[model samples]
Target: MIQRISHFFTAIVHRILPDPLIFAILLTVVTFVLAFGLTPTQPAELVVLWGAGFWNLLAFSMQMALILVTGHALASSPLVKRMLVALASSARTPGQAVMLVAFVGAVACAINWGFGLVLGAMLSREVARRVKGTDYRLLVACAYMGFLTWHGGLSGSVPLVAATRGNPMEKTIGLIPVSHTIFTGYNAFITFALIVLLPILARLMMPRPEDVVSVDPRLLEEPPTVERTLSPDATFAERLEESRALAILVALVCAAYLIIRTIEKGFVLDIDTVNLMFLAAGMILHKTPMGYARAIGTAAKGASGIMIQFPFYAGIQALMDHSGLAGVITRWFVDVANVHTFPLLAFLSSAVINFAVPSGGGHWVVQGPFVMPAAKALGADLGKSAMAIAYGEAWTNMAQPFWALPALAIAGLGVRDIMGYCVTALLFSGLVFVAGMYLF
Candidate 1:
């Protein structure tokens, strides 16, 4: 009866707090109250500034949410799944699937971290469906392999740009320049080796199922579905093209604003500018200006909720910074640890810290203040340190509970399954750490 009551309450919370947006609101309200106590400055004074800054921050949050939603829509389609299956079918064994997925994920992440979540999940599911072994645990493990490598590749915007915000390494290492630090020979070698080594390790670590259980015929029964005769008059392509107009318009406006902002400000423009642009584009493309307005209203109905909660997360960052907790921790890492080994310590520090703070931006924001200074002081190569931090952040995602949420949902797998696969990845990534130490 007690367990039943507990389960009922859990279900109720899941229903009521159905999304992160809801969590964001509650977090913000609590943060607003807590912020009053954290800062040395008075509440009224902080409020005046926070009031001015809050809108822009909220706009950024909304933009992040939109991009994530839009990306999910694009990647979750039937066509992409078909492509992934065709590719995975070539692999003969479960371990091969792990390597293939990890390589693809690393390449994609090398290109863009945001895409990593979608690409990894979609690819893993596709491979799982095709492969003989569809144990939820084994498949979940395969999916996260890609998640591990994605950080070191070209696609990761976080690592490529984090140091640009205020990295001293950018200044000191003026002689050895490249568009991406991780694109270097050393980082590339480590990334490639891990991609290759992880599968072999997985093969050893994971034993094949005792006996393959044939799936039940009834469980796999075909659904009664309609078959469409060829429509000579109508084409899906034509319909897709017609619908493409709105999507294209929306994409162009967002891209234009992003480009303009990147050129002027050196990174993507502030989040509000991008969100407002999308909102405006949505309005204009609709039947009428009023239609556009209504669309914006509907799309942004959740913005208020997000605004309320994100500030608290922000407050968490602020408290850590103001209380000197993050610094003290960083200081300890610097003082006691012998970092003369360069990439090794860099990788280790990155892996450990990433477990606690899963965000590249947040990790950079906190660790950057102290790490860059310590690296210079130790006579360690700055670029290597920066890349190490980036690599570590990405590498550790293999184990981060925060990032595992999406993979868990997509694979219908539990935490235990995800962790099981990552154990091998952890061993493979250790090679990356050692390689980074010696080369850099």
Candidate 2:
């Protein structure tokens, strides 16, 4: 039954869903029409909102681009490739490969979402290479499914932001500690449940032998690196570009900076830090300046979607923010919610909002002010309320293709190829989230 359901969704999504870029474009049009209809803002003003917010995510887009390129380069380095291959070798069967990728991706996401996004996809490709007859699309989907645990984990943007001092809602809610939010008994139970159940879910969703779509073996084969030959009389600049010494020196400098930052800040893991670390690792492992450059060139090809599509989503978020549409949606849920039902309602509302504002931090910014005040007035647990919003933002990501771009780019698949499995994940995990909201 589960397999049938999975197949059903996969087929439906494959047939109906367009390319992710087209999906984003359609979403932009839909949000524009909705904002125009729902808000008091005039159509002219709405156009301004979209235009004004279009470039709002420039810095964030650059960071995302860097993460994708750097993480890919790091993964493609000889040392990391060998390590991933060794790990993939342990999965003797297709089912084991699915479970292994799912488990590793979940754990990685728990530690750092950016890292997990790239690691899971890269590892899935490697696993497909090592384990014949593995369903490649399903493998990538399972990898993306691991992202569901990110909000309950250490780098969870919503909880981490709420815990920080001077946050916008700090006056109303005060600084809720991580213990009450991320590390609480209820959260622990939810996280552990997902870590266990998701793998089993992936295993159950595995396609039959004849139906499985394995990766093309040629795609797994690494392209041979072309070295520019230099005579003994090579120019000084040519020598410098090809020098192992230059790459090692830069790597050492980055390493020292990372060590110093860790000592000073006690293990801060932001996107910038992750990008730098990956850059350092890629340089060190690639063994020469030219080799690292070549790897980066290879990786940059995968980041085009990220570079192009993020601004549209940023504009969508801006439209929601400026046009008062997001607030209206939140307040409607609050108006209908009782103390007992607020968390679940907030969770569901957040799931809707996440399709527009996919960033966890961005979601909290818009929803926290309204949701936190409502929680306080109703005497609900603020911690759980915050987490409910967090979970919702993470939950709907199964259907939201924005966050999946990096993973899909790395895996050489389209949104339609994997979203069917992800839709199934969305439904199954939604039940778990509802249970967590009510039971604990």
Candidate 3:
């Protein structure tokens, strides 16, 4: 009877939400209610809930603009096709192929996660075709391995640090001394190393083909137009180029963010002022309601989990803050830990949360308050602590189901296949996590 109830709830979750975002949100709310009461003793404190709700909307709206544009730009490229082909040609074994796909997925995600999602989805399909006798599952897994690890890469984490700029905590948590340049370069190097090494590792753990069924050969066949045609009327390339309208919209939004950031530093707008300004900016900049509406819709589709979960986390922190649980938790962890353990915990927490709550921004929203205070109290490498959070969020991204949906859809594979490949990717990721713990 209990098992039946559990299955029933799971079925409902899959039906209504059909994604991790809602799940994250529901879990957060449940945890918050369990941890705190239905109401705070001071009704005025409810303002925190309002503040968190706005933060969720604003942050997610911004993320949608970024992801949509990046996805369109990266997906339309012929280079993505070439990269997929090159990967297919290079790998000898099923495992090797999976690693290559994952590496590429990570690269795509690092460069731009929005792009990573679309690119991985499209490329995984191509790989499925090439591995004539292999199950599409391996390719799907490869895509997610890359999809999941992306937060640790440059594009996602650096922006967060940059957002904080020269504030006290930002300065103290000097994870990337050179800021964006160093962060991207370091992440790129890590991405490259993973690309090279992951395939070799996959080759060792690859399961026999007898256990997995092969896909249809028709799926592998390249279209005649792919090889043959150029048209004067309107080339395929032109159609592809036109699709970049949304991408341009997104780029402009990011540019606006940078511009606002400059103004913010020059004038020192308070958080509330900044929020209002951005809200106004979004309203003005989007112009047509449909464009902004589309961006929001897309974001809502992708980031509902982030939207719901972040506030719950905020509430959790608020409970801790108001009730003194956070202080107690911090003191306990600090008292028990040595310096070596702190970094390890930072990495572990990051990995665990990344899997459960995959968005970097959302994770940071909750983690920043808790981790920041802990870092100050514990005397851990503050910069490294920040990076650890960033890194942990990124490392587990390689396996997170939150990111697997797109890849699975594109590749015509199941989650099981992707999870299988992730098993191998996680082993190496663990090693990297340990190294980061010690090195930083």
Candidate 4:
């Protein structure tokens, strides 16, 4: 029955979903019409909001692009490839491969979301290469499914923000500790539950042997040779470009800086930090600057979707924020919620808002002001309320294509290829989140 349901959604999504770029554009159009039709905003005002907000994510876009390119380059490094190949070899069967990728992805995500995103996709592709008859699409989807645990983990934006001193809600909530949020018994239970269940879910969703859509064997082959021959009389610049020592020197510099920063700040795992580590690792593992550059050139092709689509989503976010549409939506949920029910309602509200504003930090800024104050007024647990928003934003990401962009790009699969399985993940994980809200 689960397999049937998975396939059903897969068929529907594959049939209806357009290219991710087109989807982003359509979303922009819908947000524009809704802002004009449902809100008091005029067309001109909406256009202004869209234009102003379009470039707002320029820095963020660069960070995201780096994450994908650097992560992919790191994975393609010969050392990393050998590691993944050895890991993939342990999975003796297709079902085992699914479980292994899911487990690794979940654990990595629990440590840090950006690390999990790239690592999981990279590992899934490797597993597909080794595991004959594996459902490559399902394998990639399972890897992405592991991301569901991120919000409940250490790098969770909501918990980290709430734990920070002098945040806008700090006075009301009195600086909720990570102990109260991320390390709580309820969150621990949810995290472990998904870690265990998702792999099992992936195994169950695997199609019959004959029905499995395995990866094309050729696609799993090693990247084409980019090694350039160097004569003894090679130019000084050519020697520098291909110098292993030069790459190692740069890698060492990055490593030293990262170590110093970690010592000073204590294990900060933001996107920038993740990118720095991956970049350094790729440079060192590739053993030459030119080799790393070649890998990056190959990886850059995958990032085109993100490059084109993010600004549109940024525009939608701006329109929602500036047009007061987000406030209206949040207030509607708050108006209908009370002390006992506010957390659940906030969770649902965040889920809805996540469709437009996919960034966890961004969602917090928009929803935190309203949700926090209402939680206090209604006598709800502020930490849990904040977490509700966190879980909601993370929970609905299965359906939202925004966060999946990096993983999808790495997997070389379209959104339609994996979202069907993700939708199933969304349903099962949603129950866990709702249970955590009430039982915890």
Number of the top TM-score candidate: 2
lDDT string, candidate 3, 1-440, tens digits: 32233234334533454344445456555434533453333434544543454344445444443443334223323554566667667766566566667677767776656556656666666666665554465566556666544555545543455356563356445433535432544445555666566555544444555645566565444422212222668766655443435545655675577578778775433223333343333333443334334434433333333344444444444443454333344344444556668766766666665543466665555465666567667776555666666777767765455555554544444444455456456766677656645643
Q: Residue 194 of candidate 3: its Cα lDDT?
A: 62
Q: Which parts of model 1 are misplaced by more than 4 Å?
A: 1-68, 76-78, 155-159, 162-180, 211-316, 337-339
**What's the lDDT for all of these models?**
0.54, 0.90, 0.52, 0.89
Better of 3 and 4 by lDDT: 4
Model 1, 1-440: lDDT tens digits are 32233234334533453344344345445444554654455656555544554443455455555543333333333444356668878777766765666666656555555455546765666666666664435445655666666556654434555535354345533322344466677767776776666555545444436622223334323223211234567676644433435555665776687778778876643234434544444433442333333333433432343345455445444544444445555565666645676556656666766644456666666676677667777777766767677777777766544455555544444454456356556656766657655764
Cα TM-score per model: 0.65, 0.97, 0.61, 0.97
Writing each residue's lDDT as its tens digit, candidate 2 over 59-162 gives 99999888998998888877788999999899999999999999999889999999999999999999998888899999999999999999999999999999
| Top of the candidates by lDDT | 2
Error of 1 at 84 (Å): 2.5
Q: What is candidate 2's TM-score against the reference?
A: 0.97
What CA RMSD would candidate 3 show?
Answer: 9.5
- Per-residue lDDT of candidate 4, residues 1-440 (tens digit): 88888988888989998888888888899888888887999999999999999999989999999999999988887778899899989998999999999999999999999999999999999999878889999999988999999999988998998899877777765788888889888899889989999999998888878878888676577777556678999999999999989989998999899889889988788989999999988888877889889989988988988888899889989998889888788989998998999988999999999999998888877888889989888889878888999999999999988988999888888899999999988988899988877887
Q: What is the alpha-carbon lDDT of model 2 when measured against the actual structure?
A: 0.90
Error of 1 at 321 (Å): 2.5
Residue 270 error, candidate 1, Å:
13
In model 4, which residue pairs have backbone atoms overlapping below 3 Å? none
Report clash pairs, candidate 3. Answer: 21-305, 141-418, 148-397, 148-398, 149-397, 149-398, 152-394
